[model samples]
Target: MRRSLQWVMYVAIKSIVVSCLLLFISGLVQAQQQDQSVTTFKELTIKSDWLGYPTPETVKSHPGARTVITNKELTESGARTVEDALRNVPGVRVFDESGTGILPNIGIRGLSPLRSEQALILVDGIPVTLAPYGQTGLSLFPLTMNAIESIDVARGGVAVHYGPNNVGGVINFVTKRIPAKKTMTIRETLSLSPSTERMLADSYIRVGGFVNDKLGLQLQGNFINGDSIRAHSDTQVTNIMADVNWYPANNIDIKGSLQYYKTKNNLPGALTPESYKQDRHQSTRPLDRFTGDTLRGSLIYNQYFDNGAEFSWTNFAHRSNRQFFFGDALNADDTSTLERSSPREFLVYGSEPRLSFYINKGIKQKISIGARYMREEVDYIVDARDLLTNEFSVARDWRFGNHAFAAYISDTFFLFDDKLKITPGVRREQVYLDFRNNQTGSKESNPTKDWLPGVDIGYQITDAIFLFGNFHESLRPVQFTQITFGGAQAAERADNFEVGLRLTPLQNIGVNLAAFRIDFDNKLEFVSQDVGFRNLGKSRHQGIETEFTWQPKQIDGLDLRTGYTYIDTEQRSGQFKGNELPLAAHHQLNFWANYSRADWNWNLNGLYQSKSFSDGANTLIENEEGSIGRIPSFWVWNAQITRNFRWDKRKIKAGLAINNMFNHNYFFRGVDFSRGRMPAPGRTLLFTAQLDF
Candidate 1:
């Protein structure tokens, strides 16, 4: 573990160097123009402000690959869930097995799933992960899409300020910061469909004000209820949130927030081979049952120094418990052998503490760099039936804990005073991992040490065009979620190279094109099994992603966003090599158009992904020397309309959103196996209305 003193010393030295740079810049500013000397970035309304705040000026000077979705986009999309809204963004692919809530395996760049361990989900600067179980944001997400102010995606790699687990990237869902004035809000939504029906209610009310600046505090909550196509299956979730902020000091601010969530739902597990023959969405066995809940709190402190440097820290913690079983019924052997039995259970508790340093002005460079430390601890216990005894017993007890030490430095310097921009950066990370096994002592091992390094670069070709290229390496260890009786696997290593261009052929329109190739060694691959999974070897992922967005400055209310992705894969060395990536499409296209005016808002969203194979083998069946399995490609659509009304100083917006608008049923992902598949949700309509005063 890195001692606190080491962290402090690391930051102190960097801060001293940065302070000196700032002083030098101050001296030069008198000779040059203030506005002209600032490193101006191509600002977008979507808030690429991923590195810091929403000021377009601040982001242009940020040091990493960043992308954002604005508040308007979030509201206009009429997306049912947070992940639903983000999937349309380039470089983001969300694969859900069923319509059962959100199943997010959010991959960035060309990371291999098996080795893709790190990726952080942040809410109000707080890290959200179900510890012990290692289920990415399982306890914290499924957020109501409309409440978010924007979604910031820090692509490639980022520092640990937002908390570790983000080797692939960091996604921060910055919710609506409380308004500066007293206000009240009430919102409700109802959806009815063949596969599911849900009702959600949430409200927020701000009270009181700080000394000079307006003070703000608010409360928000949501409830969702639904059922799947299977037996003895139903799902429910309730989330409550509170936030308070104080900006008494003009240059300093502090905010505290808390969120509580509960879910009585199923994992949408796989069905047997026989069930597929009857109906892809049908199941005979009572393969259902799951329940879970979570609670968390966070405190964030931010300070802005007059010199243009900013600093912040986020402290957060959460706990969760979830259970799974074969519906509410018990099997003959399992029940007959035991006097009393309970469903399988998993529990987690964790805390994430992050510190960030943002320096916007420097003598010789336009830079944003910082160092961060994250300590996350997790514990897991499982109970399964014995082979002969048939009675369930303590099958596994595991403890997963890691402390990460990371630092990054980057500078984007301007040549010719301001025209050309050149950026260079490097990051280093050291991780410590320990696993304790109660299943048996043989499984106990502590690989407590590893180091990874990263580098990135970008340059401007013309004022309207930019060229960027980067190469970095990252390590993905076998997280707690991958633990199985087969023995934990070794960490996977990846070396990635990418080169791209960001172009603006016309003002108000932006286009980005990137081609990437990643090589994976010791990639994690697994197979179906009870309790755990079976491992497979090395694999690779390489692909291309593009995005085009238009938010015309002159147009009063018109915004269009579109994205296309093309991915190519080579197994390298595995049961399946030179095969395309499965559970992922080779080609994906999405387009969204929105028109918002004072009285009404109109929106349309559409998506189509080329067919993809299932599982790593790409092969369908195995029992009788081999069979066939293939999932055909599909298309999907969604649209919404909203109108606002007022009642005695209160503001209200009513809207209807239709998913799968054409009612064409499809597969969430191509399914190929006796394990059966889940049909995508049929055409569904959601009615929602919100009131604010």
Candidate 2:
């Protein structure tokens, strides 16, 4: 009862504070009222299918929590990779596994970050995972930081449009678009690790132009070569892409893209407790390595009708191959003479068509209908090699196939002079999957279907305050391994809830606060050797996320952004009941501050995460394997300084960045292949230069 009273008091105080802030800012209400006009539903609904929220106003009006990390912010922060740029997001957590950012392990709201399987990752609205429905794990991430223009993350109210693995939400990496004017750019970045005595370089080139009034073309390339902090950790990456846009008529638009990406990296396998104490930077597994490549293509078509209606069709296809080599021992300390290798290849194709129209007879409404079809094929092989004989033999060979279909319908209603908006939608999914064990001469098929329903509401309480809420039912389809094992038959389901407030009390300041809860069911977990995989009972995850931004009028050319997240998770059943989930930190905070003066800019930023358990058992003691223990808290800071100059009518920029300025020592445990401690990179310095002609 005492705790309940305190919670009530807290809620009352927050409400009072918000009320006072709104009243204080009401003096500008007249100006706001004069400038405010209702945006037509058609105008707001018709935009690029890839964009989560196209404009700042749309973001504010959105019925759920959303964030956009812009290119300017990414550059000013001196971000070395996409992972570096995403660190500041309120509810997202990114753990470095490959050190080169070639592989991403992203989690949201206390979900497991392993392989980022719970989250739906997209590149310009197209799925980037090996297989969207059959195998959601992103063994090969094809995005390069130099080619990204922005990142869009949506936490809720998105299930009606996206699916299969969206319980954690949707993260879209938007690539750079073709410039309207002819331009060519060249950029290079170099970084040095003092502890490992290794140097890395990143090169980028972009050429774009408009050939005529109706046609535009662009080409981009990025190359990376480097060594991580640990021994025997060499990395190389290549990305090449071409984009085209054509406006054949006033009402028709066509866009297409082709991309190729490849990466090869050596893994410094994890270390045991004793080995870690002796030398954390030493690598015992010199032969462990990973290599991946992808070739992808996409096309989009849009047609606008005179009656305030729009139609769009999108198609995409990709081929990907990934391979990993590791020793045949559970512990890196073991002097194993045998090695294991797993190679997987995937072929995926998808198509989607959508239609949106306006109906303004009784009330302003925007209605949208869409359908999607996706097909996937996977070939998997496992091989074992003996060091004594230098011979290799196949251990397992499997083939997997999936056919998925989905349809959705949604209508958004505007009421109370556009101050109140409500949207209701539903989506249906049908999937058929089959797994063939070539070595065993056996095959199994699993067919499943589900319906997802969601609703979103947004109300403008005042000129400076907005309230939004959403409830969505989402699911994660049965993956490749789950099908291969033949124990889990149904998809994992979850009910997601979110409520938030977007406040702009002052013209120069903005704030966002949101509370979210996820009730997950039918979770899949590895059981005993006899059972293989099973559908675990239930789990609950709840959290609070808040962010603040200020561009104070008093301090010219200075900007500040900060955010905090609090998460609480519980395993509701099974042996781990009442225990916190692995890698789910209770508290996280991040901040970025930038100052500009006289052609020079300086930035300081940092991230802090509280201690978390490495295993579901919540073990407090350090285990011998270094995989079942409590992870200590850490603080990592970065700083950058840059200057702009003019060279014979050409523009030039140069900068220096220091990562891990404090020389913090941190490690991530229980990653793929090696369930032991993996040391993070130490202090590093980067130098960058760019030229535009």
Candidate 3:
């Protein structure tokens, strides 16, 4: 009987395999019949696609938007991260944060990217920000540029199709989907920047391939180490990610991913000018630091019905535990005081479940709807002594659970062979915080709700030219960090408008110009606790941007991506005016130009963000500036040249990177010390070599 059952199971498995093989082969044949033509356009010289949210409804009569950079772009541009790669996307502003040590903060129009999750970040449709908060900084989630297949920056209502967070638009880090052929990568970076203690080394290895037409996978891992360019600071980071995709039928596909990450740093407790001079680097001071581990997994399935109906489901979960060591240098050897640190380790974890559906085709109209449910819990305790010896105090111990729910609906209408398209969308979200973890509360936690709507319009003058505009509203509910005495503001909102023109004058060149305004209500500002519980509000912002790409006919192997942004941010209702937004620049200029021929490649890239206020308050109180607390202007230059070689089936490449090519000095302000200023990293150098088979 067991043998018979095994035989039956084997037969069923084989039959399923045979069916999938048939479907895959059929898709291949069909794909071939479609005359798979290879175009030289790597998104750089291509016109706008309806998939992006770049326009406003009434202005454009319809909505069309999307910007892309191909794998060839990554290779040719020689960018190292999402920020480094997307310098030319319309309305994007990248700014340096004093000591984050990851990458610059990214913003759209006038919205501060670091302040809220309103500006969403996605990796192949998966979120990168575990939580949006000051402590939950962007640096927490690290992504190597090498893993990117393309990057799509959608502004205005384009964010609506992505669900409710579409308020500030969306930055989708579309990962590289392995091609029909195999691919491999190896990268390494070195630094000689001045540090408090140690040097820096950042390296990564990624391999991707398809076992067949229907199955593919990508495995990647990396390590990062850098010393404080200022003082008393050192950083070490490492992470690994794995992704797999499978197609079982012509219309159905499944993808899954797993990630593990860890980071350790010599955290500077806080630097006052006196301490700053005493120790140029924070790592030279105390050893109070933070170390943490995070593990995450996600599974997604996509199905396309013959009738043009579509459905998708994404399940994701993240588990992380982190500990903060309070300053205890006063009496370390003493066992009694050794455990008397001011802060203790806490634990938290959460999960997100999402489902979406859509219908498009002959329908003249397309509709989409989706939902997400998030729940998280945190545990905290006080340490007077050992758990066995320490007496637990109800007043000091804390624990809690929080839940957030969201749902959204969006649709698009097409006219004139889709030459004119309009997309309208809306989303409703509710959040509940349960002090369920703490037994000491007369009231555990409060609940909140927010509603956000967005719109996009696009007009295709011709197949290769389109003009668009967008209106997107963003909402960010108060996160756990704002739960100081439960008096935190309910939620914040921003209404941003963007109008732009995108044209592919020729098959080999593209240009985009845009003007935007982001008016925000109750936007978070930096203020002293002595002033008020909340930051200053009533801010208005406006900006203009232009992006360009060119691949000259002479150098068919050359690709150039560049752009500029001029931002005007003001606290129209507060004390600050004429000052640029905090943590964002008023003028950002960046570019990438690469020339490749034969076995040699030359790439030059430069990034610049004009000085702006480092403090959200835009004031210098008890500050060195005496009035305006600002981050002075800065620029960084990088150049790379590579030589390619091949032996049999093996391909090899060697390159060099000159970071901050010139040993320039600059201060990174926004401080809590006698002097509120930090220095930028000095000139650094690196080399790398990669082999592929």
Candidate 4:
């Protein structure tokens, strides 16, 4: 603990010194350019200011594959969960373990989808993953769909700006900001299932206004209560957030935000094939439950100089507590029912500073430099007891801490009369972790460092066509759990190569195609029932993703969009060599169409996935219990209709949606060693109403 404190202090002092130096340089630059009028830093009104929520045009200029889902797409899809919204993003895998969509198992490319630990998850550029270097479960997503303005997924070549676990990519959730004028909005939604009656009910309210010419305030609240498709499964989630934006000077802007979230979920354990056939809605273990709460705060500062240079800094902190009580069905022997309770507390604090400036040569060049420092601490305890007596006995108690520092610089040079762009970047990252087991009086520590470099090149072929390519290197550090139990584990490294094209044949039509390959070394594979990990040596993932969108002028308001992905993943050098990775489908497709005329809007969407193996061994034959085998391909469809009206200058909107239109039955995730499978929800209906004043 003393060492950790000292390290924290050292980083703090270094950050202060660097910040002062940057400020001094910025002041000098401003003074030299005082003759020119400085542009005032506007309040946070556009979503693009947030790190990940880049606009479509911005995405076209990005170095590698990127997907951005905006509010318009969210509204048209009527998606109740993040997984639903991400379906259109190719190369992303969503394992629907929780029928209510509260606990998401998300993966990008061919990475493991276990708890979404391999990917970096952020909210408005602030890390939200619980215990990033220890557990890293995205169980507590504080904001609801109503509060989100955009979702961005960057597949690779992002390590230069985002650090640490940028192995798979970066997923950033951007929340709505204060509007320019006073506004109040209320929204309500109800979901139902033929098998379980009422499935979910949600309520959300938001108010935003300008307190003064230089100040803005916003407040939001969301409450969601739902019953899962499985029997005895219930969930409740609540979130409250507030934001204040102040412009103390014409060239300076400051924003502060705070958010609180609490959630409880009743976990219905998986069931065998016979039980599923008898009744899919029946729960095998009804007492399993999970609860969590999180509090987060952030302060942001931005300064603009007359020479069009910008400096920004953000400081953020998060604290979270989570508890899980679940049936140990996999280890149960039928003689005695066993249960386990795991409780964890996580604390994280971080700061990031960035400076960007433009150089006007023959062609303009943009250069950005950034530095980040983060410290995280986690305390975990596990207890075991009999199901009947409920007398718990301590099994394990562990404490873990991680300290990380990273610095990066990126330069984008424009050539060929601003038609060709070349970007080169490099990032240096260092991570240190310490772990102690209180019950056993044992301690361990590990330190890892890496230098990542990348280059992106883009050429405009024509007025409506563009071609781009990128190559980057990224790394994922071994988590504390793996190092503590599995002994020493090597950090995973990945080299990604990608080439893509964006073409706009017409004003209303867009097409994108990308082909990429990733070489992974020292890959870690979960073993021992996911309690530990084993070095898989080497692996490779190669895939192609294509997307098309069209808005026909003939059908004034008609919109159509579709995307497809083909992935080939192999374990190159391991015991499972020549085998396909588990749970990664070979083919996936998504399609959506929406039409709007006047006050009425209608939309339909569908998703399809090919077969996938359930175990690393690539098990093909289905067992008697249907637990270990290849999952068959399946198709699911959804539709929605909305109507808008105005009464006395107050706007009102109503919508109805149907999910799983055919009631298809399929499993996206599976447990190994004859464990039961995770089932997806059946046909469901949802109704929504919104009022704006």
**What C-alpha lDDT values do all the predictions have?**
0.56, 0.82, 0.59, 0.78
TM-score of every prediction relative to native: 0.78, 0.92, 0.78, 0.91
Q: Give the TM-score of candidate 1.
A: 0.78
Order the numbered candidates by lDDT, best leading.
2, 4, 3, 1
lDDT string for model 1 (570-629, tens) is: 677656766666655678888888988888999998888676666566764422211224
Q: Report the C-alpha lDDT of model 4 over 1-693, residue by residue, as the tens digit.
A: 656764664454445434434433444454455543333334533221324346787787666788999888888778888778887788888776667877777888777776777789888887788766555656555657778888988885677677667767898888897776667999998889977785788889998765445666678999989886777678899988877666778888877777788989887657777777878887666557788998777778888888878888888777788887776443344443667778887777788888888899667888888898888888888888886887779988998888888889888899988789898989898889888999888888878788999888888878798898988888888787776774677788888899998899999999989999989898877667556777766988899999999999889999999999999999898778989987778999999899999999999999998998877789887776666789889999999999999989999999999989899987654422115767788898889999999
Number of clashing pairs, model 3? 31
RMSD for each model, in Å, please? Answer: 9.4, 12.8, 8.5, 6.1
TM-score for candidate 3, residues paired by index: 0.78
Of models 3 and 4, which has the larger TM-score? 4
What's the lDDT for candidate 4?
Answer: 0.78
Query: After best superposition, candidate 1 residue 169: deviation in angstroms?
Result: 2.9
Q: Quantify how close model 1 is to the true structure by its C-alpha RMSD in Å.
A: 9.4
lDDT, residue 47, model 3? 11
lDDT of candidate model 3 versus the reference: 0.59
Residues 222-278 of candidate 3 have per-residue lDDT tens digits of 887776455445677787877766767867777667667787766553344544456
Q: What is the lDDT of residue 94 in candidate 3?
A: 54
Among all windows of 10 consecutive residues in model 4, the one with the lowest summed lDDT is: 44-53
lDDT of 2 by residue, 1-693 (tens): 434533543453344334333432432343245433321211122352423444466678878888888878778888877668888888898877777777768988889888887889988888898899988887788888999988888887788888878887888888887776667989999978887788889999998755554555678999999887777789999999877666678788777787889999998878887777788888777668899998787777889898878898887777788999888443445567788889998877788998988899999998889999987888899999998799989988998888899999988899999999898989999999889999998888888799999999999989899999999999888887787777546788999999999999998899999999999998887887678778875899999999999998988999998999999999998889999999899999999999999989999999999998988899999888788799899999999999899999998989999998998988879577777887777888989999988
